[model samples]
Target: MVNIANYNDLVVGDRVIEAGNSENFQTGDWRSLIPVIDIDKCIDCFTCWIYCPDDCIIIKDDMIVGIKATHCKGCGICAKACPKKAITMTPEE
Candidate 1:
């Protein structure tokens, strides 16, 4: 027989028993918006990279390069974080 814990048996606090496993899921298809970058307005300050919850910002040589669309949920967090207004969120096609 399998033993399963009921809701009444669960712990009350937010606890992490394991390391983050978000990389195993591709959540981009759930997004309704997509981010577009204007390279000319980008200063490579990494603001987008810093604010991305999904780690979807791509970086190369200490510079912001592009977005990793596969894991990006398009939450618009990166676009809102850009100080230069370099990133824009557009409706997904």
Candidate 2:
């Protein structure tokens, strides 16, 4: 349904063009793995939030709810930084 023939036509020299805004993009599909949060084991220390490169960890009422999978790249930084081992990286289904 989409056309790729025009892709070459859109290219500019060297520099890459800034496409549409990232908010409209769902990059989670690019990940082969996903982070899973066990809120029960979470100590509410905010460590995960501090280490999450994508800042996809959801926080509310001073508590971490979960991750926003849409922007998460499954880099595992949050999981590694969690002292409570509350976050785990799992294969995406």
Candidate 3:
């Protein structure tokens, strides 16, 4: 799918990009889960920041919050490091 949840614009203008040679768009192919931040529960622990294997976690003002969902391999390290039980592992729908 073309990320229907986020971007709904399907308009395609003329471009030099070619089709058919691109990777599979099949549903059976497995994909990784990307994290979204819940700022309410974030306590600036920075534990999730240090534990991220891919260094995907985003930090501001010393707070450990969201991970780079696109790059995240769905590793549970961020969820484990969240001392406040803020991070939750969710399947990509």
Candidate 4:
């Protein structure tokens, strides 16, 4: 993932284009926390997938499978947004 701190340095022309562009940056490595999914608790509501700023949530057959740790920035929005409370943010070791 592109360094978020450098975003402010970019000009108007330097912006992501197309869908899923964040994949190119591999930003998850920069995160200090990681999101863990409790599959048993998950209702497959997709709340985390919809709220992920980095689009790291993986979905299959309309079911929320897991998170892409390589692209996740450890933002706790997923955990907070989950109505089932299936997601939790933990500090990386």
Global lDDT of each candidate = 0.87, 0.85, 0.63, 0.84
Q: Write the per-residue lDDT of candidate 4 for residues 10-89, one digit (tens) a residue.
A: 65785655786655778877899888999999998787888888888899988888889888888799999999888888
Q: Supply candidate 3's per-residue lDDT for 86.
A: 78
The parts of candidate 2 lying over 4 Å away from their true place are 1-20
**Compared to the true structure, candidate 4 yields what TM-score?**
0.74
Pairs of residues clashing in candidate 3: 34-69, 44-63
**Residue-by-residue lDDT tens digits, candidate 2, 1-93:** 974566566656655477655767677777777889998999899998988877799999999998898889888888899999988899986
For residues 1-93, what per-residue lDDT tens digits would candidate 3 score against the true structure? 553433334335634365763223332223365455577888776777878876678776666545665456676778777788777777677
By TM-score, is 2 or 3 better? 2
Best candidate according to lDDT: 1
Cα-based RMSD of the predictions, in order? 5.6, 3.6, 10.0, 5.7
Per-residue accuracy of model 1 over 1-93 as CA lDDT, tens digit each: 788768676556755455776677799898888999999999999888888988999989988888899999989999898999999999976
Model 4: weakest 10-residue lDDT segment is: 2-11
Global Cα lDDT for candidate 4: 0.84
Q: Model 1 off-target regions past 4 Å? A: 1-21
TM-score of 2: 0.74
The C-alpha TM-scores of every prediction are 0.75, 0.74, 0.56, 0.74
Among all windows of ten consecutive residues in candidate 3, which has the lowest summed lDDT?
Answer: 21-30
